[model samples]
Target: METQDGAELCFPQLFNTSCKKPSSSTTQAIILYTVMSCVSLLIVALNLLVIISVSHFRRLHTPTNILLLSLAVSDCLVGILIWPGEVFMTTNCWFLGNLTCVIFMFVSIIIISSSVGNMVLISIDRYVAICDPLHYPTRITVSRVKLCVCMCWLCSIPYNSLILKENLTHPGRYNSCHGECVIVINPISGVVDLVLTFIFPITVIIVLYMRVFVVAVSQARAMRSHITGVTLQLSATQTTKKSELKAARTLGVLVVVFLISFCPYYIFSVAGDNSYTSSAGFFVFHMLFLNSCVNPVIYALFYPWFRKAVKLIVTAQILQRGSFEANIL
Candidate 1:
């Protein structure tokens, strides 16, 4: 399984909990799990709708939108395959047997790895488009975007595939009866995954975005200088200034969303290997999982087009409901 650094560090403690006898307070656990499962389902549905809406509407089919659609699809799979099973196991124990367990674990790993990889790709795409406008069009063509998506999947395949094989074949060392299938953390492998999945990609995103901000600032300054040189063209300068300001605001929002969604999990994981056993660790992990649901809501609230679409859909639904009520009466 693709355990994040926090999970890997904390697995020993979690494994201990899993091995304990079944609890009688399972009803409470069940209720909590069910609620979370429903929430996850709702998020998956919303993201799926967003992806479909973007795909079907010709206006939303740009390269950035395509990348977002791919992310939604990946996250949808994660929510569907991983979250329900997680909810089930948390309350009821592992009832799915070993084969299904292996499959579910494999799927979870693949989806998470793919999702993170897609995020990195998105950051790179944005960086190029924003910072290197002259070359972006030639460099980031449709075919090239397709290739990048393909490459992300290709990179994820080996980690998920090998872990699945290991789980199936190494039954002596591994136990699936407890309802958890995770990679046994070898120090080297654990470090490698942490660096590749979290450290390296995050570093790249930070660096690229920082460079983009610097470039944007420099361009704004240069534009101001040009405006002053051209006898203080206030109208053109103001328009250009406004556009630059909006771009900066958009990038700022993106960075904030990314940090809010991902930073806690990474921080908890990296602080210390022993930190995962604490109650705080579990809370942080759950918080990270919940972040998958945030992107659609963020889009709806922040982007005018998405906000309009959401309003239209909601109004139509309400009108349809009212008509049904009247007919029934």
Candidate 2:
């Protein structure tokens, strides 16, 4: 009986100090592993297409595409690092040590915070493009957007490090036993994280998008009423307006989907949820992970340029000389 019980412990030699193995049946664990593996691969592959599409095609190198590229980079990291880490936590012990666990925690927080920052920046971009088109060309240049993306990432590292400072200084402080990896955010830090990372960014995104939507609808109505007769210059202006409106609609969908995926995790965390072992916590986490996969799908479904670029990429046409000069838009 002692031998059999020892087999259930994550570190048999540790005896009383070791964590017990997870209790799920082998079949269920296998199914979960398979599903998560496929999702991780899909996330990486799709985001890679987005990254290449925006980077290789000069025509797609607009300010908005630059923001999308930054987002895809963050999402790809989610698949490359976070997914594998979560899977390992699910199926095995954290034998990698407390330092590794804290590092993973820090990196994951950086990714999450950067994603929120990107969403806020995208919202601001759309707002300027739609609500202040005259100044947008001067205001939202590619160079400016790239700088903002860099600042977003650079700021994330320090911000999250501050939030996880306790865990960083005392790795594995929250672990109940050997073979466990955990981090606890005290109530004070949790409130700060909730406000800055969740509430503040979300509020800004919602407000900017709301203003963009209102302006877009008004512009669309104006264009319809003025459709009868116009000079060539006025017609071209109308065409630009139409394209801006279409982009607003597409990005509106993106923001809504992001909120749907992200809100549950924050909500559950606020409700005092502690462990991903619980069904509710499990669902919340996977919902958040699914967002990274769903974003590239949104791009494919809404952006004609994305579809055209993907076709070129998959057909090996992108390898041809002068492909960067190809007209993707």
Candidate 3:
């Protein structure tokens, strides 16, 4: 108690109850804030570019890019809404009060759950396109994909509300002191969240991608082998096969990167509450958020249309007539 008494309180007026200000040095805080600020800004800007390119360009519109568009919007929201609030909570104290806290948690959960759902949808789309090419066209149309996206978000509302019901109903109920706003869940709830958000979705992604990888390798081998047939028909089949493989590879890279970033955060969750809120946990959460920034980079690397669109959008050429119909693909 005597040692703790020397520590500065976040809310000095709170007397014995306020949390002590974190013992990080001024230099460390500055550095941390700088890095986080840069990351937050990059996420917002990159995802904004994705949003504009997808929304503005008609030729780029496809079922798969539609899912990417949905994910980018959620990522943009993470930058705009989650980052500022997180910056405040981590650096300073929770001065925003209970209501804001409740809303923040609610929105965060919804967006995150919806993101996981979107990933699952993306994996399924890829799976069908690759493993079951014949049915993919009729099965995974624009209307159906859009419906799935909407349902994913709509379902998140009730699902997360139930998960966070206590926090919503009784804001600040889990805080240990005046300045803290941590959300605490029991082991049961933690397991439930893990199974729903991380366990099941990740399992589906990995399994589907693994299968896709094997089939892709075989298809690549087949592409190399000679096929004796009529010239025009053989060329068309080769073109179609090449297109499917490219789509699979691009989305495969995206999924791999996502899993690498996301696994740590949830792995820590399974480690218990202490680990979930620890400094290490905070770092993993940052890694999870890092996925948002990495996504547009992936698009830039793999998608030619994204690069062309970025070029046009940057020069404000997207505003010109017939720009939407430009041969971006």
Candidate 4:
């Protein structure tokens, strides 16, 4: 009888202090694992492709693609580091101990917040490109963009370190039993996190994109109505305007999808973190993670350069010496 009972415990040796294995059925657990594993793998593969495509192609090293590449790196970590840990924790006991848990939380927070930072940079890039095209060349140079991305990441390290300091110092104080890992931010800290991670970044993104949308529409109408110059210089300028307009529309779609995916997760935080492991919570969390995977798909759908880059990457043509200078544009 004791042997049979022991089989159900997460840490059978420490019966009183240990959590029991979750009561989900074997088949159900298999299905959930299978599905989540696939999602995690797909996220890794897609984001890896984005990272490789942008990094390998010299022609794709524009300010805008630089931001996307930064975002892809953040998303790739989400796929590689965050989601797998989440999946393991959902159906299995925490076997890695408290230090690993603290590190996991710290890294997850950095990856997510930095992804939001990238989006804000992207919004600013689009805004400048559309509303102030004349100065964009100087204002949004590749060097400046690289500097911003670096600062965003460096700031994230300290910011998340501060937010997670309690967990790091105190370790697993919130866990009710062995075989479990939990991090608790009190109400005040939770409010601060919600504001910092969601409210401020999202506000900037929405406000900038709203301005971009207005400016892009007006510019598109102006381009349509005033098409007189057929000179080579004029033609190049017109083509540049058309390209900028299309890019704005594409990025606008990406931002909308990002908001939709992440809103539920933040809204849940606002409501209280009580439901974080509930069914609704699980769904929203997965949805938020899914945004990482969806970003590259958005690129594939809207950016022909991305499609061509992928072709070159997959066919191994990028291994050639002159591949970097290929006319991806």
Using lDDT as the measure, the top candidate is 2
Task: Give candidate 4 regions above 4 Å deviation.
Answer: 1-7, 228-232, 274-276
Model 2 has how many clashing residue pairs?
0
Q: In model 2, state the lDDT of residue 134.
A: 99
Q: Which is the better candidate, 2 or 4, if ranked by TM-score?
A: 2
Misplaced by over 4 Å in model 1 are 1-21, 24-27, 163-165, 176-182, 221-252, 263-284, 311-329
Scored against the true structure, residue 233 in model 3 reaches a CA lDDT of 72
lDDT per residue as tens, model 1, 1-329: 22333232213445543443334466777678778878888878778766755655556556776777777887676577766765554444454555676666566667767877877877777777767665877988777887888888887988757534556565323553254433344455556667887889888878877887787778778776766546556666556555544544564575567667667766765665422323465466556566667777766665665665555455664245333222110
Q: Rate the local accuracy (lDDT) of all candidates.
A: 0.63, 0.89, 0.84, 0.85
Which one wins on TM-score?
Answer: 2
The candidate with the higher lDDT, 3 or 4, is 4
- TM-scores for every predicted model: 0.75, 0.96, 0.94, 0.94
Local lDDT at 291 for model 3: 90
lDDT of 2 by residue, 80-141 (tens): 99887877775778899998988987887799899999999999999999999999999999
- lDDT for residue 162 in candidate 4, whole number 0-100: 75
Per-residue lDDT over 1-329 for candidate 3, one digit per residue giving the tens place of the 0 to 100 score: 22355877878777778887777788988998898888899999999999999888887788999999999999999898887677667777678887787788688768878888989999999888888888988999999999999999999999888887788888888787887767766677778989989998999999998898888888877877846544787778777888989989999888888889888877777777522245785677778888989999999999998999999999999989989888898
- TM-score of candidate 2 on Cα atoms, chains taken together: 0.96
- Which candidate do you rate higher for TM-score, 2 or 3? 2
